[model samples]
Target: MALAGQPNVGKSTVFNLLTGLSQHVGNWPGKTVERKEGTYSHNGISVDIVDLPGTYSLTANSAEEVIARDHIIKERPDVVVAVIDASSMERNLYLVAELLSLQTPVIVAVNMMDVADQQGLKIEPEVLEAALGVPVVPMTATNNRGIRELVEAVDELTRDEATYEPKRPEIREDHRAVLEELEHLVAAHVPQPYPSDWVSLKLLEGDDEIMRMMEDRLPQETWEQVHEILKEHEDAVLAVASGRYDWVGRMTRAALVRPGVGQITLTERLDRWATHPLWGLLVLAGILGLVFLLTYSLGAPLQGLLETYVIEASARLAASALAGGPSWLTSLIVDGIIGGAGMVVTFIPILIIFFAMMGLLEDVGYMSRAGYVMDRFMHLMGLHGKSFLPLFLGFGCSVPAVMGTRVIDSRAGRLLTTMLVPLVPCTARMVVLAFITPIFFGAAAPLVAWSLVGLNLLVLAVAGVVINRIAFGGERAAFIMELPLYHKPNWQTIGILIWQRSLAFFKRAGTVILVVSVVLWGLSALPTGDIETSFLAGAGRLLAPLGALMGLSWQMMVALLTSFVAKENAIASLGVLYGAGSEAGLAETLPTIMSPAAALSFLVVQMLFIPCVATVVSIFNETKSWRWTLFNVLFLLLVSFGIGILVYQVANVVS
Candidate 1:
């Protein structure tokens, strides 16, 4: 069985409810699109389920569409569950129309019935199932309603005794003959597992993937003959779409009852301010400020407790346990491994709060409004408005930000957005700022932190404008997105999201942070267990001249270098370099060694520096070109240092 739906139709929520923690997530083979697979078992029946990418249609215009259609055709899941928004059934049915034409068994899952009810819309699932000649199950996935029924529906369809014959859509009267003629011509040549009639429709629709596949497989004369029909009837694609909409119209008229005129919905009342040109910006700002305030107020204290009790106590216990071991072994376990990675591990509390807040906003359907509000400003940078959604994801993490670019249909727009995402000051960078800003600026920490975030976005905007002109010739793509109706957020869904993201962070601490810390400690302990006379000291001094221009000491320079491993490692590396017994010890030591001017410059550079290794790898994977990847790294390096020097020199003049 497979789950498929348009974007924001509660498909993923349903998947989460069914699979829970028993899901495997990874990329599609040789593609950046994510794939999620899980097993469902109930009543002595077991089934494998796949969650396909959210796409508006099955046309081969985007990688997502190709992946979705190919999976249904090639892999051929036993049951294809089509999840649709009950409130927007007319628009959602277009994909179902395409799916029915594929000769597969489809179960229509009418999700978000609660949202439909709130809007005063009523849909009869029985009428819909009868009209479409398929099973229809009404559901509110977020509320955990109708899930068992949906599962039961799936079970019934998969049984050997079960049978279904769906009413599929067809081309217009004038083009039906042409479709049949094409189908006849390719009847024998149509590849295995691909229905000849469906291939014929795609050929008339000028589907690029199908055209190329047929062009290679068909004889020259047959190809030219097929091409002539397509050339003569160029509007056949429109005819096919009109037919699908005609089918959808019939289904809607039979089952959907619209609200009375002048009836205002909750989404409508809220969008008046949420999507406003001016007020929306204020609302977005206030919301962001609230998120940060929550992070500092709630996450910070929890982080401190973890640091004080868990990390510090663990270090002491480890040191005591290894007391009789070799001196080098003791230092390696306690300082190298625990000291470095443990500091980053303490960031879990802060990351959880931040992730939970983001998940809540997204689940409640505000993210689309946020994107709509930013569309105008995004256009100024030659970006499609939809690019804001993925760029916004950068606030949580860059990996998803990069992956989220798949939502953008335009190639140039997606690439440009990917490049800009690294500058978004993700939670890791925010965590570093949260830790350092208070120690440096005291009561003005919040103000300084806000200013640094503003600075990163400002630089990102300037870079986008310049790069758009030089590389992309300032070509802008039009934005089109469907804003999901606002609904009550589900805490279970939000908790699961936080758990997944927080688990990823913990995995990083165990792998990347652990390796870097151990290696740095080894470098600091070699030839003698004294950090001052060890390998790291010689390396830090090598960059002394460059450090002088930015008021950064050699230790600060080394910390910045280690940050490329992981942004959180900057603090951990400092602890290792300073030999701070605890986070408080490092905080107290940092101010005495560096002046306020130097501290400010270091923070500036840290915020603007090249992203960590994982983000770099994601960029390379997405772009598939070492040239662009190297360009991004070098561009950020120059910008970070140039601004760092300017800030340091100007601060000195003012002080």
Candidate 2:
């Protein structure tokens, strides 16, 4: 079975519900398109489901459309379930009309019936079934309504026991004559499993891929005749489209009942303010402020408890256990392994809170509005509005942000967005900012933190404008996104999302951070059993002259260097340098070694520094160019240092 729909039609929700925990995601063969497949047991039989890309139509104008069209045509799924939005049936029916032309078994799953009902709209499923001549299952996939009926319809269709033979749309009378004539000419040479009439229609529509294929397959005379017919009826393409809309209009009149005049919906009421240029930004700012306030207020205490009771105690216990062990082994275990892992574990609470809040925003459908609000501003930077999503994801992590560039269709837009993603201060950097802000500024910590975040955004916008002007010179892709209606968030979905994200973070802690921590510890512990004389200190001292320009000491320089491995490691390295037992310990020790000027400058540099190793690897994977990857690294290095120097010098004079 295959699931197909336009954006925001709950196709993904249906896939997740059916597949549960059995789904696997990978790239489609020889394409960058994501392929999702899963298995579910239905009545003692295992059923396979493929979730195709969400495309508005099967026209081969975009990569997603081409992939979806080819898959349904070649793979020949048992049943094609067209998921339609009940509230916007008129627009969604366009895709259904195209699906019907394929002459395959299709079960119309009228999704979001609850949403339609909320808007005072009535849909007659039985009337629709009569009009379309196919099984119609009304459902609210989010609430799991009518899922069983949908599945049973699929099962019956796959078993060849379906009751209805779907009524396919007919072209206009004049276009139908040309299509019939062309069909007769190409019927013998038409490819197997593809209907000759469909081929004829596509040829008339001037589909480049189909025209090329027919030219290669048919004899010269037949090819020329087909071409002549297409040339004569070149305007028949509009007629074909108009015919589909006509059929859709007739079906809708028979089945759909519109709400009374002057009826206002909840989505409409909210959109008045939520999408306003100025008020929307204010609302967005307030929402983000509240989310961060909650995150800090809730996460800080748990973080403290974890560090004090769980991590510190565990470290003391491990050190005692290794009392009789070799000295190097003991240091490696207590300092390298336990210390590194403990730092990562302490961040779980903060990350969980962040993920939960983001998931809630997404599930409730406000995030899409956020993208919409930023679309105009994004155009000024030569990017589509959809590019905001990946940048928004950067607030959580850059690895996924870089990967999220797949959502941008244009190559230049994706590349430009990828280059700017690293400038967004991720949660790891936030951890550093959260830790050091209060230590240096006391009552002004919140303001300082806010400023740093604002600064990151400012830098991102400026960098985007500069990069766009220098490297890219083309019209920005138009942003066309459907804002999903606001709904109450499903707690189960939010829990699953947080769990998956947290699990991925823990895996990274174990693999990348673990190895980097062990190596850094070796560099600090080897050759002299003293950090001052060890190779790590020597390296920092070599860079100390450069660090001095920014008022950063050798220790601060080493901490900054460790951040390239992972931003959280900056805090862990500070704890090691100061011999602090916990984050609090390091906080108390920071003020003694640096002034407000140097501390602020250090924070600035960390905010603008190169992305972590994981993110760098993701950049390489997405861009497939070491040249761009190295450019991002070198570019950030220069920007960070230049900003650091300016901040440090200005602060010195003011002080």
lDDT of residue 617 for candidate 2? 76
Which candidate has the top score in lDDT? 1
Residues 1-655 of candidate 2 have per-residue lDDT tens digits of 8899998999999999888999999988988989999988887879999999999988878888888878888898878899999999999998999999996788899999999998888999999999999889999999999888988888887777446588888888777777888898999999887788888888887888889999999999999888888888889889888889998999899999998647877898898899999998788778888877887789878888998888789889988998998989888887787776556777778778978998899999998898888888888888787788888778867877887789888889999999999999987898889889999999999999989888888988888888998888747666568989999999999999999978875775447667776887888897899988899889989989989998999889898988877787888888877889677888888899899999999999999999887788789989999999999999999998899889999999999
Model 2 bad stretches (over 4 Å) = 1-203, 206-257, 399-414, 434-446, 571-595, 617-625, 653-655
Error of 1 at 107 (Å): 29
How far residue 153's Cα lies from its native spot in candidate 1, in Å, is 37
Task: Please give the CA lDDT of all the candidate structures.
Answer: 0.87, 0.87
Q: Could you tell me the TM-score of candidate 1?
A: 0.62
- Candidate 2 has its poorest 10 consecutive residues by lDDT at 505-514
**Clash pairs for candidate 2:** none
